[model samples]
Target: MGSAVSSAAFSTRPGLLDGLDPEQLAAASAPRGPVCVLAGAGTGKTRTITHRIAHLIQSGHVAAGQVLAVTFTARAAGEMRARLRGLGVDGAQALTFHAAARRQLRYFWPRVVGDRLWDLLEGKLRLVAQAANRAGVATEAEVLRDLASEIEWAKATLVSPDDYPAVAARTQRDTPAPAAQVAEVYRNYEKIKNSAQVLDFDDLLLHTTAVLEEHGDVATEFRDRYRCFVVDEYQDVTPLQQRLLNAWLGGRDDLTVVGDANQTIYSFGGASPRPLLEFTRRFPEATVVRLERDYRSTPQVVSLANKVIGAARGRPAGSRLQLIGQRPDGPEPRFAEYDDEPAEAVAVAGRIRQLLDAGVPASQIAVLYRVNAQSEAYEQALSELDIPYLVRGGERFFARKEVRQAISALRVATSRPSGADVVEQVRTALAGVGLTEQPPPGGAAKERWDALLSLVELAEELAATVQDADLARYVAELEQRAAAQHPPTVEGVTLASLHAAKGLEWDAVFLVGLAEGTVPIQHADGDDSAIEEERRLFYVGVTRAREHLSLTWALSRNAGGRRHRRRSRFLYGLIPEDHPAARVARAQGKTFGGATARCRVCGGGLTATLEVKLGRCARCPSNVDEELLERLKSWRSDRSRELKVPPFVVFTDATLVAIAEQRPADDGALVSISGIGATKLERFGAEVLAVVRAAGRG
Candidate 1:
């Protein structure tokens, strides 16, 4: 672990090294040799590397055209080019690995293979679907995503289809399908691509490497053309990527790699931190510099980030770069707990409202969660609060293809009365589109499944609260939702997953849904390595907060549901075990809820959606069915529309919620409810009683 380096350590210099700290200046102007930069999160890695490129150009060490810099994403590549241009240096090749490789392959294919280069595949889902069919596999749209990921992994790891099964089995890879079936799919995918004369993203790198490796003259020309190389996010280098990097170097050592081993959370995508960790071993005389001073987050946030990553197991000794915050201290991170998922979302949105009210620009704040599926509740909650929010790098809730299809199916279902439970009816409709209880293997398919399953949860909530909930009304709500999440003229708070939130920062970050199964995730249960990666991902989330940070989770998924969820184990050492936010000490089974939840009406355990939302239960002397209240509200809304009156004219929302909690079985008890008088009861008594009876509440 590196110690804190104060500003006293930085030495002033002229030209490109003007504002660079001592470590950065050393790394930037290091002798012409292999350079390794262990750039911790929030450290000025981009600044150091980009300045180094400019330094090399102005100092006559390397020509601008010969400098090839590659990063993982196009946005980062574009930023690199823009920064280089800002420094008054032009003609440098700053591009994504695929972009750089595609250009090289396109230029060399005719010379090397004596034929035209095939069309490059921007996405492999279409081809994977075809391959799935050829393999006698009936793949859904989501399964195609899983297959594509598996195929990409195999190709990146340089494992042939014949070797994929053994490699996958050896690594205990959680393949989308059986090892043999996936291998067959991969084999057929290659065959189909070959017959169609096309190359994918991975094939570009592979082909470029092959051209250089086979043709000595071409390799010499390429190496001479591009004399200096700088690779960002070196910890994410897959085996195939590293091989191509080596071919680009052509046995020379004019290479610089910037990465942090602790931030290596993309292992599932075949990325290995080995290249970054063993950089010195590859080039014995490499100049290694560790940039531990973080300039983004405050000391309080930095300390939390350090603790999170430090708690991970199997991290290489001395390889974990301990971050030292360079910024002034702000407020300490806040930890919050809620009763359920919806409660969590509402609370987060309310906190954001407070921040916005206090004059923090919405664009400066963010709400990040473990997965994209968790985005829907936040979207709905924000919309309810009239708080603008944009789902960054994810599909908006109602805009998803599955959601649109499910809504269309539900619309068709309203043609006749099914008389079935709304939740069950939703299940039937979703199943018509191949969405069932069990989700497919991880990746796009699993994410799609999660997105669709969230709809079922909404239906369950609808049925729990609304006695007269039907397919038509549910479809109406979804349509309203589709229209509600519109783009605002003003910049909105960002909602993104942890993976997407990487490389970004926010002033106030609300990290929600940190429950046991969500942050560590259920799939990482048995694997220590997977769990460690989760820890790293959590660390990433923690570091994204520049000042105000709130880490929150819920006791249950829904109101009144069993509060059995344990806080994420990653927080065990970070937060106090006996704190109110952490309700239990899992190892000791000790309880820590500040206030025990008890039903007000019957003093019984409150553990279901309606029960918690109502704060009461059935079997009380005066009762109103929570389910019946929802039914009354739905009926009241439709009735009010017919009568050309407001919904409150039929029955207030509070009255309906109270009715559900009271579980009133008779007209006498119904009239006793605050919102129901003798006159009002006379008008709607028969219809309300019929709904309650249908709900088995009367």
Candidate 2:
């Protein structure tokens, strides 16, 4: 029995380097000091990092608590910690860059500044708007939001207000506002934040770096505490983060960085792959290892991803790491074309239903697109089909407007320096916000209320664990928890943007809206570097599949009433002329030229006049009452005129057809149709249904 027990236990515990390829093993076992791992997509980068940490600990080179592992997202950090636990290691400092800085600030704040840390300013845009107003700059919400983004970009790149115009001219980057105007707003915004005595998220890293640089003892303490560092997605490191990392290292070269230059897609957010590209120059003796073996995607998908990456220019010459797929051969990726966006969404939804029917778990599939706005049609289609799906990278729970408002109120009530009981302070904050009453009836409002209530419950639980139960301490913990929170892992299909889908994989993946303007993204029109990053974004999407993959695009968009679109240029180069997928896409495009232009509403054949310009077919016999249909058209036309956009932008003719056919009486029923989502439903549901009721009476 003892021998059998020992065998089972040993079987459960995998060896540190059991399944790693030779290159990965080399990376994991390399001597310490400035190691760089150029890991391609689907390569076992995470595995290599985890194994390396375990090896270091098991070999008695470093204690678990002394190693700091940083990743780009909370999900990645949690996965690293879990993997370490499985490897019989714990208490390691696995966190995001912001989380690590926040911890350091909390630890050294008293020693450096001799006071409690100020609250983090969550209303950054609001403050920017106020500053813009005071500075006599345009205070339009859109302008403020753009300027706020510019401010963030400036800080991340360590550009000061005085240097804004010179930097903008040097880079030849376009700004939504004039460079001088943006500079004015940035200066005023800083003055306002300083007057308010609050630090924004960026200020956490800035302040921590300041503390470390100005105080030798604190810097020494941190360096002694964390002797080794491992940074994941090192290509996306911004200058500010690099400076902070350097401060923590105290000029030591004990760092392991893993990234792929081909996957650096966040240049717009002030990230650069230059650090990863120049690692060898910075540390001449650095050991460099490349992991080319892809363990996530099948051979076909891997081939396509490599082809996409090959088209990218401006990469370090001869430094591109091509991925070799290890997963078994699977179906060649499907390329589907549709007449319009709505129809494309319908077809994709049908395929998802089929996959689920074939016993594939809903959680094993994802539908990825270029922008968040592209998710509406897919969300509507999935909801109509009753397939459970989760939309990632939307307003996160903590970042929602309603949640922010509640948190702001809580901050006000707890901002006092007096030592108040945590539970009482939280109760007072909830009561102050008028959340003491029952939650309101609307779905969104109810969710907001539940989030606040959950915070209250958390405070009570926290109070039991600490002495004195200070509200400030509770708030600090709350902020830390929010930073590390991941989207709840409900069983559902994931709908995410390509940027959000990095480091994630699905058994079956759908890449949608691969049109020229959408994939290269309209902003990237004439810029070579931006286009290359777009191609890298496409590569990221392609490599997310393990078995099945589909690349889809529409011939025209429904929003602007049938503006024609071409296939993405990246696809044109990546899919060779003789390739079967290319041929399939071309063949699919041919179906639209015949006399078979179908009704966007019901998919019925349209007569010649109706077929022209995609008009509705009278002979098809509308399921919608004729009067109701006319009224919806009138409402859409008026809204289009009010918004100064095309009529279809308000509600496409196809969506009207769906609404008429369904005759939804309420918001719940109205949102069930394709093309109608929360925003549209909230904007037009009452009026649309009022028209339906009048028609019913008529």
Candidate 3:
């Protein structure tokens, strides 16, 4: 340590490793030579990686500029850079794979081929459509999109156009087009891209790997420049990415990778955990470290995550790292079942409202779903409740159909020689799409208009920032920004897809749509690997919770006036009927009658006559006063109409029932209800008590 410290700049920092636990400290200080850290969620993976970088530089084992740290997103790269700066380290290169490859390609393009590199193609679907036309592959737009995605997957897996059909056939993976037709489309796509002198995102890695492999001198230059390499989220690395890393290293062993195989949720994008799983075999001298202590979630949450991952199949032996909770004991993760999607959404919104009243910040709570489509119900429910929320990782603003239409019109309108002002062009585009300053009628339509307006504002701001900014340059910049756009931060509840929730944590998480076809995903029906990836995705969702966690699923989904669904198999053993963590809530449908009565709090059914007379299941507390509850509901309805808001916004039915049972006589007592915050108490507290008093007298 003494010899290593003399040449480094951070020798004076005394408490660099004080906060890290023993395992994390060992990982941070491990000797550098093909090191692999299997870091589970909330196990201080970022801290360990950043501290390891600092340790290497402070010990003088690697120069700051000579280290290359690769992350999966621009935000992650920024976070790592900030951490390194805090540790008194500078000049280290932290970049995403695409960013790093794009840089190298730009720097070495002239040296390698002596020709100008084309701009990356922004409209992949357009190119795919053109290819479809050339190949005479007449199909619906959905089929065309599926083909485009398959082409991307093939490219990432390094399958040639000629080999795509064979590979797909051998693997029996589902495809929208026939194998021959898909291959034809792929070949035509290549021709179209070559003719236009453009490259898509995947080509960035493909072309760089080609250049480095074809030119040993160029590879040697990179190898000399970057002496140490560290990769984050290594479990999601594509084969092509692995090859690029190997080419850059050129047989050197100065490599460290950190990831959790159980959190590998991107197999649909052709990412595989094999590179991480087989790190020891790839680098025979590798030092492997496992970080198991989870500092983010409570013991209950950690245990539930462990149980979910333990049931997953096809994981490598000894690869299942159980998380030892580092936080105090808390409530067990809850499971709620609903009759349908809309009912499930309402129940979840009510629960979120309760949590908010209990003083949990909205930002600390998240609603996670298996797919983007599941968000619509929750969005409607939250909107009805007047709850603020921000949807992440769903459709991008620029990708919306209306926005795209507007942009298309703008491109044409601005292409003229007269060259109208940016604002005028935006106006023209909106006019063409039948949009004006006034918002649309429906909530969804209004949202689309707002998104387009934001785009217009963004254009105006960009133009103002740059004097004489033309429409063409402005459009190019917009495309670039769209490609790199991360989810925006807003003060509201988060609604995100499971994929988007990775590497993020919350104090409470609601995992919705855990039904059979949704969680396992219909696409993974016959594929073992695909199913395993779905399980991993569930694991990722479970581990995102720091304290409170809830899993919800609907018994049916309505389509064309028919209901269909089945419970997700993964939840069978996890939330059995007798499980202490499980709860059932009645959906907005027919109630149980005859021989049994269902608990309104926990979905459990009560069969005995005494239990039925008590009007509560064995699991939850006794029922509220029915007549008083009806009076409260009537009052809420009248108040909602008076305020021109939804009934739930005034106060949820659950909150009203709680108030009736408590019989709060004043504002202070009213505020004690689960959903009655200070705002509600001040606004309608007196009226609520008057209703209660009148009901009591009656």
Q: Residues 1-698, candidate 2: write the lDDT tens digits.
A: 00001111221124666776777777777666788888888888989899888877777778988999998999899778757766777678899988888888988998887888878887698999888888788888888888899999999999999999899889986896788888888999999999888988889989999999999998888888898899999999999999998898887998999999888889998999988988878888887888899888889889888888887776684258888999889888888766678667767887898899899888799999999999888876775455657789655767756556766776676757655678878877777655656766433344456567767777776666555767776676566556687433435689999999998999999999999889989999888888888988998899899999999888777732474788888877555466554322222222332445456566665433223223344555556666778888988898878855556556767677667676888888887554466656766788898888888888
**Candidate 2: global Cα-lDDT?**
0.78
In model 1, state the lDDT of residue 504.
78
Q: Please give the lDDT score for candidate 1.
A: 0.78
In order, what lDDT does every prediction score? Answer: 0.78, 0.78, 0.78
Q: Ranking under TM-score, best-scoring first?
A: 2, 3, 1
Score residue 573 of candidate 2 by CA lDDT: 59
